[model samples]
Target chain A: QQQVKQSPQSLIVQKGGISIINCAYENTAFDYFPWYQQFPGKGPALLIAIRPDVSEKKEGRFTISFNKSAKQFSLHIMDSQPGDSATYFCAAAKSGANSKLTFGKGITLSVRP
Target chain B: DAGITQSPRHKVTETGTPVTLRCHQTENHRYMYWYRQDPGHGLRLIHYSYGVKDTDKGEVSDGYSVSRSKTEDFLLTLESATSSQTSVYFCAISEGTGGHYGYTFGSGTRLTVV
Candidate 1:
């Protein structure tokens, strides 16, 4: 079963615009949510993450808005730039001694300058 | 940064052949994972190790086996390679159960079976 679902298979936005990608999870047991950014020929790097306790998290130009009741989370990029063009993946995992991650299909974002 | 490396960045093997992929880590993390990335499939876990000699299967573990003989090395073996198994494999390391801290991934290994 696909535990995590992400929307917008691909996206295109103008530079300095706000780019948003959303994701939903089926497992309520999930306590941690993270977003990863991957460039071509490279590994997926952690961008930002949020727990069920917080409503939102911001790191520089990237932001993660989380809704525990809705079982949903989103990644928002403010002032999106061309350098931000890449594939983004959203993942969820439960808190425990040995928890595994469940990931979404992924979204390809493009920022035109 | 967590140091993780996947060997044979790219490989092509014939059907019915045996293939082994290696994941090496320098951080000595207790958790290690193997995942395959495919178009429209996302990242599916194949196997994971919590400690030396302790391993378990993930969602998509068919046609694959894993061994963790040492704390720093995890091996993924395909007894009989198949074309359907072609995908980019990634190795990830986490200090904890991955909930507290995110995983650090390697560059990935692109494998193709013909």
Candidate 2:
């Protein structure tokens, strides 16, 4: 049923530009939203995450803006750099012990030098 | 990343053959998971274990079985290889329910079923 849906299977951005990716979920039980960054031949790493209680979270150049009422969230990379080029995945899960996650399809982001 | 390792970074097996992928952790985390990655399908959970001898099936557990005899190791086995099963498998570990603490994934194992 594809619980979480992400848009723009791919993206391209110029250096020093703002890169944005969006995701939406249908499950109201989801309270935690996390984003992962993956590089070729490597495992995914946690980039950033946000909770339904907060509207946004920012770490360095990466930011996650969440809309709990709308069941949507977006990742914005400011001053994008070539090193930021990679595949990004958005995932959601409920709060509790042993709660598994539901992930979106994923987006490949390319930042031009 | 947490201390997670996936053996057989790459493998090739013939149809109907059985394959087992191993995941070992040094972090002593209680939660471990096996996930498969494919084009157009980000990552699908195959199975997960909360503690030794306590395991549960995920969304796509068909044709796959898992066992966790110790908290440090979790194994995923393919009963019979099929071309459709060829995909990159990843092992992840988390300290908690993944609600507060995010997961750390292994490099991955590229499995090819011919």
Candidate 3:
């Protein structure tokens, strides 16, 4: 059922602009949400994550905004740069013994200089 | 980059042949996972192990089997490779804490079945 759904298959943004990617999850039990950055021919690496208790978290230029009631989360990249071009993924994992993380379809970001 | 290594980074095989992908981790993490990545689909967990000899199925477990005889190695076997089995496979490990919130992935193995 694709526990997590991501939007904007591809995004093209100019340098100095902001890049935003959104994700929605159907499972309310999911407590931990994380975003991953992946370059072509490489594996996904952890970027930032947020727990349900908080509404937002920021790491450098990357910001994760979560809406507990809406069951959605978003990743915002401030001051986009060409070097930031990569595929971003959002994942959801429920709190407990499962430890299984479910990921959404990725969003490819192209930050033009 | 997370102390994970997948062998046969690129492989070409004939259908009906038996092929196996190996994932090795130096972190000694308790959890190991195998996933497939495609154009539209993100990462689909094929199988995972909580401990040695304790493996379980994931969303896309069909046509694939996994084994964990040791703490740092997980093996994914394709009993009889097929064209549909062609894809990029990744292995990930989850430490109790630190860098990765969920897991850390391997470099990935690109498999092609003809």
Candidate 4:
């Protein structure tokens, strides 16, 4: 079973526009939600993350809006640039010493110049 | 940037052959993990090690095994490789457990089983 579901297998946005990606989880035990960005030929890196206690978290042009009741979270990239184009993965994990992350299928974003 | 490195960036092996992928870290992190990436599957954990000689299986550990003999190195081996096993393998490390600190991932190893 896919514990985390991410929508829009692929996306395209014009430069300077907004890029949004959404993810939902079935596991209510999940407390930490993290988004990872991966460039071609590279490994996925941490982009942004949010805790269940917070409804929103923003850093620079990247923001994560979370809804605990809905078990959903979304990533918003403001002023999207070509460099921002990559595969994004949403993952959820429960708080523990050995808990592992459960990831979504991932979404490929393309930013047009 | 996190001092994690995956060796043999790419490999192609015949069916039934054995393959081993190596992950080395210079940061002396306490946790090491191996994950596989596929088209429809984002990333599936193969195995993880909390310390030297202490390891555990992940959700998708079948046909794969891992060993951490030292604090800086973790090895993943595929016994009798199969075509279905072809995928990009990534090695990640974390200073703490439960991913509270997130993880530092290596570039990845592209393995092809023919």
Q: Which ten residues in a row have the lowest lDDT in candidate 2 chain B?
A: B93-102
Clashes of each: 0, 0, 0, 0
lDDT of residue B56 for candidate 2: 93
DockQ of candidate model 4: 0.79
lDDT of 3 at A105: 84
Score every model by TM-score: 0.97, 0.98, 0.97, 0.97
Clashing pairs in 2: none
Expressed as tens digits, the lDDT of each residue in B1-114 for candidate 2 is 448899999999999999999999999999999999999989999999999999999988999999999999999999998999999999999999866788999999999999
**Residue B35 CA displacement from its true place in model 3, Å:** 0.3
Candidate 2: tens digits of C-alpha lDDT, residues A1-113? 88999988999999999999999999999999999999999999888988888898999999999998889999999999999999999999998878988889899999999
Lowest summed lDDT across 10 adjacent residues in model 2 chain A is found at: A96-105
For each candidate, what's the DockQ?
A: 0.86, 0.86, 0.55, 0.79
**Model 4 agreement with the true structure over A9-67: per-residue lDDT tens digits:** 89999999999999999989899899999999999999999998889999999999999
Stretches of model 4 off by over 4 angstroms after superposition = none
- In model 2, how large is the Cα lDDT of residue A11? 99
Q: Return the DockQ of model 2.
A: 0.86
Chain B of candidate 1 vs. true chain B, TM: 0.97
